[model samples]
Target: MASITGSSISSSFKLNQALNRVCCLKTPSISFKGISLSSSRLNQATRRLSITCAAKPETVNKVCDIVKKQLALSADTAVCGESKFAALGADSLDTVEIVMGLEEEFGISVEEDSAQNIATVQDAADLIEDLISKNA
Candidate 1:
């Protein structure tokens, strides 16, 4: 009877530990999704991620720089050219990298199908702006 009691107590303690561990794991995830970071903090992070917005004239140039570096493309040609990524000779693998790079830089995930529709640099910037506002 004493051995049985000891086993029961040990099992209860293990169960409690398991529950506590689950709670600890879930707590931060719940808080992170529920809490929205302040704009100043977000903007600072965005700046660190290489997001830059200049006046209209420099806008395209900056966007091109971001796309070129992020996509590992030639700096000589403009990214604003009227060419879809698929039309620009990018394969499925290259397109995935491009999308991932954009998401990392913008702090948002561009849906796979929607990414296929992006034709110009402004399209990407617009989507990032929308996603940032929504996430905020």
Candidate 2:
């Protein structure tokens, strides 16, 4: 299977890095895998931080980083569960914004209802990757 990998970094750091990677450039769907973070290194990362994504591990980490930065939350505040948005601390507006950002980043349209249905980062990533494959 195809996968993309990267080193683990702070959530904000990952966001800046991903945004920079796609700065002002139209691109295809990004296929990346999980980011490896040593437990020790994650300790160095912001506290209560949670990273999750529907894409590969690397993409998941990137998404987690961005979300962490936007929400000013720690990793503990984030998760990759299959529940509801309210259960995940995402208001309707936050969900919409996140959906829009993910669409731009991965080139997919996440239906509002669909966005509401996504409770975990992995769910979101899987949806994005599925859309990418369909577009491809």
Candidate 3:
């Protein structure tokens, strides 16, 4: 039993190495764990990686827009910089959706701790600005 287990582990390692080499070759696409990664997808990812630093006011306005849209608020709804999401009638799920909207809009991923710390629209704007700068 022990010999069989050891042989299986060694075979698995060799298979993984072979897969890595094949995936590393200049191919238009590669499949791993049932997910296909294409060159076009890689290009899109590279495009998304090109972050631009926007002015503070612009970031705030964009963040507000994302929040308003995520919450399905009226276009005329006032989203003040200091307004807390809770004040805007956002529940936990709403907050998560808002965070997702922000991520999609900015093309940047927010850490769990950082996302949890966002309470106000201004907080979200500030975090987004910071992320943009770091990504830039």
Candidate 4:
């Protein structure tokens, strides 16, 4: 679990950035908590829920940065732990490239099954940490 404190502003900013990435994909709508949210409504929801991160913030940050770079996202585009690769416009080939970048950056080799399961930035970060500890 991640803590919510004085960094709420930063957290919210990252969340909004991530949400914006998804919105740019032109999704018609998404349902969460039994509520169907249009693009505009999802933006509102993002502002309300940006106080937590499930993994180490540093690891998450690195993953987010790598993803953004791999996808050629603009500087203003924010990538957060919850940001999914598919939502960021990464296809199968792009995903493979992202995994390669991560392997080089983290000095860890992700097994085929593990790589297949990394659908989100958080997923990649979590796997990196797990591999790091196991190797150490």
Off by over 4 Å in 1: 1-63, 81-83
| 66-89: candidate 3 lDDT, tens digit per residue | 888889988766675556788677
Q: Best by TM-score, which number?
A: 4
Candidate lDDT (C-alpha), each: 0.51, 0.54, 0.69, 0.74
TM-score quality measure for candidate 1: 0.45
TM-score, one value per model = 0.45, 0.49, 0.58, 0.64
Worst 10 residues of 2 by lDDT: 20-29
Clashing pairs in 4: none
- lDDT tens digits, residues 51-102, model 4? 4434577998898899988999889775776778876789999999999999
Which candidate order results from sorting by TM-score in descending order? 4, 3, 2, 1
Which candidate order results from sorting by lDDT in descending order? 4, 3, 2, 1
Per-residue alpha-carbon lDDT of candidate 2 for residues 1-136, written as tens digits (9 for 90 to 100) = 2234456455454444443333223332333445443434433332223233235666665566555555566655533322234444667787777777788777777777777776556577677777778889
Candidate 1, 1-136: lDDT as tens digits: 0011236567555433333223212121111223433445534543443444322424445555666775677755435422245434567777667668778765788887788776656566666666767899
Better of 3 and 4 by TM-score: 4
Predicted structure 2, TM vs. truth: 0.49
Off by over 4 Å in 4: 1-54
Pick the lDDT winner.
Answer: 4
